[model samples]
Target: MQDKSFSPERQSAFDARFEAQKIAFGPIVFQCVRYAWKRGMLQALAEAGDTGLSVDELAATGRWTPYVLKVVLETCLSAGVVQLRAGRYQLDKTGYCVLSDTITQINLDFVHDVCYVGMHDLDRSLDAGKPLGLQALGPWPTLYEGLSSLPEPAKTSWFAFDHFYSDTSFPAILRDVFSSGARQLMDIGANTGKFSRAALAHDAQVQLHLVDLPQQLAVADITLREAGVRERAHLHPVDMLDPAAPFPAGMDVVWMSQFLSCFSEPVIASILQRAAKALAHDGQVLIMDTFWDRQRYDIAAYCLINTSPYFTAMASGNSKVYESTDYIRLCEEAGLRLVSARDDIGYCHSLLRFAKA
Candidate 1:
């Protein structure tokens, strides 16, 4: 495969300074934008159409006072989210995206609800090799353990963030999975059974073994039952971190989508070793994730790079959005060989197929 590293052309000195300022004040910018959205300022500007609204007009129409309105709108103007024309404010292209784009909304909610507060402890978490920032949410050792039990907005944002990446790739993944002619498959870390349900829907004859923690499995059970595929699905509740827990044998395929990146490299190697032992001689393992180094575009790589801190602060301090080479190395240690790697499948994801060495 070709190296997909992102290398941008050299920027002008003026552009470099602008970029530096953006990075320096990114947190403040994020909070200001989030608050503007939450307070309905963005909506009001967007709804005001091309003519836009003045600070006094926005304050009179919305719940915000003039003081808050001026502060947020001025920030939005500087950020290019909104335009000031003839003393009136209107949504710019970016502001309209903030109001209308689903990805933008999901990313914003995820950052605000799940990562913003926890990020404060990132330095401490890094030094301790633990998700110390997770204390902002709960006392779990990792984010996965506490996902099901998170508070309202955090839980909602967490799942939204997770599913947003995986769900987009499911159609392509299901095709790849079924193409292997796997009659029995195991979905490791089958959160909410979305992939399992998709697999069952794609191939009626295929049986799925859904493995996740008990709380996650319960949620998956409900979803599978509601999807009317519970009969074809077997739920296994196990703590994957337990070294003694073995994956069931005789599996034709083992599918992990956006899963392994949740753990440190050592834990990933351990899990792959277990999968290797459980696989039949001809069976295959399909691993799908966003590898920052494999992204086709600079923006995708940029997003994944920023996401690493979420792992450090909130998910697991030891894990990250890894490069494909890292995963390949771990697979080698686990007695598995990477058979093939398919990139740019759906929404910035790559699929790696493996078999026992």
Candidate 2:
């Protein structure tokens, strides 16, 4: 797979205009390529290998009509998802990503199923500082609240998108998180208890408290029981959104994974302060999240940055894929000093370790 760089600012005015047109045409291009992907036209080209395939050939082998195949393929060609060589169409790197990349496909489906309709209310969501777009899905204030209630493909795609990033990181980060040999760990925002289960399995002596909303705790409880780690895992149903709600105290390790981005800066500060207050003498808070500025790849950075809109329009209206500097400052303001930090852990995520100053 080839990754090429295109620098339009260094080019002529006409070239820059052409680049702008790409953005202008992005919606239609996305839909057309998505169509090709779903219809298996891109897969046919991929299976055809370097020999490629003609639109007529793809139609004959598949259920699609030649005219429809021709339309989708031509749009894909313009989008650089497909290339035409000697009257044969083949998948480009972009097209291959759509068809074969797990993360890419998950993200594509998530956008289609979860955000496509709601995102149209982005302007209103921004103005109100609330997830006004969420009404399109259901009558929930945030995506997290409506997660379990989501319909069909939306629920499937949401979990797939959420799990893909976090699941891959658990194995690699367990050692770091439990490095202090914490006997009493608290998994704050324990959505599914996956991390809590992993923590129990990582260290036989450790006991973990899984904290989240009651509904979220219910989901996590089942998984923990199935994993046979329920004995060591204590479920604490707490609403972190409640300003007066205090975290479980005497915690040796307070762990939150992809959790803090669901709130505004002030709420994050409050939560961190509560965590700091709840910490034992040697306790540390470990946070694992994808920060836009910490990303090594531009593509990863772009995806992380773009997620801010989803927060604004679907999830919490004020949260975002926070920059590392800003996030660290927020933690520090809560009296938790950033003692150690590691970036590029399991894809685009960063692990931050903090202790009370």
Candidate 3:
């Protein structure tokens, strides 16, 4: 037997290369699905449903070209995203995760339908040092605000994206944030009140204050009633970005998940400062969402697509992901100290947890 040892420098280099490769793999898989879906392969299979459909029928009755359809279908099958049998194709879980009407698929589609459409001008946005894509309405506001002009099916699709992202990780992050025990918590941008329900589930004694758009509060009312938590939940229709004077004093915790990232840096800073005033002496603030990591992944392409001019014509631009360091600095500026920070991977998204100073 031989014992092999590598130098510390060599080991570090190998680990870094492997990490980059893992990150690149996500884009490759996305490209494969995007190419196939653009060519009508995914839709054809979806329309076929459980009954299934053959490539021949897709070209004939389905009106797809035989050669190109076959190439796309075969590629999908090879990727384990679809199944082939007796010349027919059916969706596999991977395919459904990306193509079905489920929340996960809708989230993925939002990237393709809304974000990537502007990727062509990524270089221009990078050079400008400000977002320049179709969604960029101003230096503030998120991509969600611009979808108001979108028609049905597309509008519904964006809601699904919102649901999936909010539900997937916000619950667990809240659990971790309030592990010390929370008696009263406020959820900023609390839509449908589900995140509030998650907290309630974790601790029955905790009272929930749900704040959201006025129209959405109606929806949240129904959700809380159905969940049997209305008795413990208070619905408030107010812009969370507005002044902090309305917030109840002495809150045990403040939860802002997928909320603060929607605003510009100045707004985010102000929001934190206001939130600090509402916290109890020992209360903690929780921020749960994705953050940019220059070392972990290549987000340059994401910045380009998000800031493209194409989106500006259709919707307002989204706030770019800020690094954890920036988030920490914002908290510190508000006179709060970060007691804990943890990063985790969720179903198809990223999770970040922060505890108040």
RMSD to the true structure for each prediction, in A, is 1.9, 3.1, 8.0
Weakest ten-residue segment in model 2 by summed lDDT: 1-10
Error of 3 at 155 (Å): 2.6
Q: Please list the C-alpha lDDT of all candidates, in the order they appear.
A: 0.89, 0.88, 0.65
For model 1, how does the per-residue alpha-carbon lDDT over 24-125 read when each residue is reduced to its tens digit? 988888888888888788888877898889888877876989998888788888899999999999889998888888888998999889988989999999
The list of candidate 3 runs beyond 4 A from truth reads: 1-63, 66-104, 112-150, 294-318, 348-357
Candidate with the larger lDDT of 2 and 3: 2
Q: Please provide, for model 2 over 46-149, each residue's C-alpha lDDT reduced to its tens digit, 9 standing for 90 to 100.
A: 99999998767877776888889888899999988999999999889999989989989998998888888899999999999999888888998788877777
Where does candidate 1 have its weakest 10-residue lDDT segment? 1-10
Model 3 alpha-carbon miss at residue 11, Å: 21
- Model 3 TM-score is 0.65
List the candidates ranked by lDDT, beginning with the highest: 1, 2, 3
Off by over 4 Å in 1: 1-8
Cα error of candidate 2 at position 4, Å: 18
